[model samples]
Target: MSKNNKEREVTAGPVKGEFISPQELNDIEERTDALPPQEDFWKPPVRFGSVPVEKEPLGWDRRRGFRKLFPVVSLPTQVVERVSFGHPELEPNRLFWGDNLHVMRQLPSESIDLIYIDPPFFSGRQYNVIFGDQNELRSFSDIWEGGMPGYLIWLNARLYEMKRLLKKTGSIYVHCDWHASHYIKVEMDKIFGYGNFINEIVWCYETAGKSKKTFSRKHDVILLYSKTDDFYLDVSKSPMPRKRNKHMRVGVDENGREYEEKTDAKTRKVYRWYFDEGRLPFDYWTDIQFINWEAKERIGYPTQKPEPLVERIIKVSSNDEDVVADFFCGGGTSLAVAQKLKRKWIGCDQSRVAVALTADRISRLIEEEIGKIFSVPDFTVEHWGIYEADRLSKMPLDQFRAFILRAFGAVPDDSQTGIHGMKGAIPIYVGEPNQRSQVTAKEVEAFANAIRKTIRYQQDNLRDGIMLAWAFRPDAVQAAERLRDMEITDLNFVRLEQIRIDHPRFREHVAALSTDHADYANFLTFVQPPKVEVGWKRLATRSYIQADINKRTY
Candidate 1:
């Protein structure tokens, strides 16, 4: 029969394919083509008649949650400086200033014992609150244009890396709210598996406000999950008070401890409950309070979590000396709690203000809390994606001047012709140094002119002016000395040490340079000011002066 004219019969029999006739093969191909399209299949095939080949999509997944995207690429980081506090013998904790996703990817797999992160919720708003210093402001937009899908993609990428860093027996607590809690839970289940989910804790609190349109939303959901089935959790550490049942009779034990006993009505079994043994905490948590504005723990950072909440989690999920981590360490609450609990910690944040606040807060905590017996916690501060010297050299003169001024904690003055900004009462003149050995004579002349102009403009008293550069020529320094002697303005020829002092990792960089130049070593020693503790009574009697002049100079 002709190929097109022949009627191919489809049979439900195993066709041996070792050697088939050409006509039979043609018939099989034709039969396959005649079958319905795979997309039109009624039901997707199940694995082992139970497990699903593909996950069933929730309503949000179909509209906005899951998405198809390329894999995330992690960037490298360079360690800038290591800081040590009261106890220098303990292993230094790590603080990275960069994208947490990239930083977490660089961490060793299965190294972290516990992870607690309070990432930004999809609140569709911008936060631009300044916490510590006047110039230090943390502004970030958490609104996603692609809505839920984009938010999930951004979060899921980090979560994947977080899972890799978590040990098999480690646990993670993800803090979220009603904004995207349902979506977050679904994605977490898809990554960590539903069987490993431990709890969906509801943290309820009583605030002052109420919504008239609906019930007041006062609770946040904390999804707890383990990396594997064999996870570690100490529920005994987080015990709550339990009231005695009315049917139970109170009695004294042999050791004089009070106890209560009751008989089950259905099972007819007797049970003894000790008064000393507190009840285990349920998933609903209401005891912990939020950080109010007047709270001592409040560091002026909005969205700062309470310390007790993190303390309970750390105590329950991890032991002493275990590794703990917080990727979105806003105000460093987790790091502070971890340090107090004697656990090794790693913290990362992209905001410079956050890093600076964390560094300062940790230092103060060591001094006040742990410095009496143990040394302050030793830690390293690292900045990722810093501009190389070559790249910095290529920057425009105005941009370089502004960058140097800002890095040195001085505000750039665009209105003033020669002066960069006023660092305290001193006028700053920044000279351009593009990979040069010394500041040029022309730059020195301009600085002298700027000093003369500033003096003439002020017309009050001869004030000190600072001339900053990478390095100063002997002639330039001599010229500055001459200008200072002239009494027009006391121009001091200082190098970039002033700028380096503001950097968190400046000590390490200065130490590295000190090997080549003994002067750099001396500069490092000169920058270390004497520590002074001031009380309110002293401040009331006299002017409060900060011991660290470098901090106030800016």
Candidate 2:
């Protein structure tokens, strides 16, 4: 976290203006006197029963971890936009703009090879409200309602999903700080298991701040856990620079290469160390520093981390072409590092601004950072629960049709010219992708004829047909009404339902994907992108004379 986001520390002991009044001291004394005892004493041994973490806070609840938590309801994603660097044949990396829990639910289980999440620490409001997004604000409020317990429960559910999403050989790195790292450690143990716990790395950095009353907090804790005991880790992929002590003898080998030798006292054997073969890294890392304001990598994110730090974690845990995921991706440090390392990456953030920033950062990487751009696979900007209706309306005809069909839970068909897909026995015909394009009367008649030609309609006698579009023309509705009335004379017997994209029927399709949890009602929805206009103006420049300022100060 940045210095501006640091919480104002308040001390309890006596200082210049800080004092405990006489009345308050008297009350405290009275309360202390009323206590039964303060002395330490030996008590009788008590027998205890072990309870699994599935039952929660106290482990008494009958419901398990996922059952008690709000389900990450699976929803169809709309490929509203794409960022490609000329490779459409390869699988594109994914960038999701939605709650990560739900996005993870939609991903296949055991797909990710490594995950690094920098979730919001339970520090306070200022730290959690990084983007001021509605989802983040609501989540922080829920976290503070019950204090520590509420925050743990909210995080435990996501951790459980990450565990399920991780491959058996996958590893996870959770970044946090002093505020709630200990509590999170206990909860993570419960979710990932005590045996799976790996390392508790301390990331030390230098910053300009000191506390006179107490020790300054300068480091952050990164908890590492594996999905299973067989997790992959290659230390040689990223090793520290070799260092030698003054006691070691330095000399040159026969090839004139500089080398250092150390004698083993017990065996009286000499061992030589070379500079090219670097030393393995340690759990305590201090070489990497924080991103200063003047640093080019600083992209104005309140809690953005340095790239070198993220690179170390990725290099050790994953191999080339492996999948790396970051559920709480803020300024895209992890994604950019993964890209540079040649790993397939997935990033998700609830804040639209955060997701947009991530896409821009990766786009820059593809264009300028890596000179060999063609090798990089293109990535897609997908929206899960929150959709972009305007973007969808502007997509290509085939793409828009596929989006609507997938949202409607229908299978796409290309056998017929007019028939776009099928929803059970009923045939579906989609209008043009442009929102202004309306369903015409001629199109309705054509869809009816197309449905009648289908084997299901001819043999199964399926008489239902559906036309979905932005809006239907008045004649189109009238045409459907006329078809229903003339059914007695027509042997084909077709009934067409004209539905607008914004109709209640489409909302039902979205709502049908929600879990039993009530909070999921607002889970899947389409919202127009926020309107933003940029303007700039030259400001009057003011100059100050050093002589005049010095004279005035004196």
Among these predicted structures, which one has the highest lDDT? 2
Worst 10 residues of 2 by lDDT: 545-554
The all-Cα superposition gives candidate 1 an RMSD in Å to the true structure of 23.5
lDDT of 2 by residue, 1-554 (tens): 12233221222212111111111112213321121121211122455444323323321123333534564343566564556676667787888876676677667668899999998888766333444432232135545655777667667767877887789899899999998898887667666766778999999999999999988999999999997899998878877767766999988888887778999999999998887676788998887899998998887777899999999999999999999999999889999999998999999986555776777678766666672643887787776755655655566788767766655545788788778987676677777867578778888888878877878767877667666666677787777778768761121211112223235443333323322223542343554544211112111111110000001100
User: Candidate 1 residues 1-554, lDDT tens each?
Assistant: 12332221212111222111111112223322121222322242665364332253222232322222322222234343455553546667888765576567557778999999998887886443444333222333332655786677667767766777789899999999999998888777766776778999999888888999989999999999998889999988977666677878989988998889988999999888887887788898887878877888886666788998999899999998899999999779999999888889999985555765686677667656765655445787654433224434555787667655544546678566767877666678877746475776667677667766764446866557776666777777677667667775566665643333334444333222201111221221112122211211110010111011122212
- Residue-level error in angstroms, candidate 2, position 286: 1.2
Give model 1's TM-score versus the native structure: 0.57
TM-scores for all predictions: 0.57, 0.65
Which residue pairs clash within candidate 2?
Answer: none
Q: Each prediction's Cα RMSD? A: 23.5, 18.7
- Model 2 gets an lDDT of 0.66
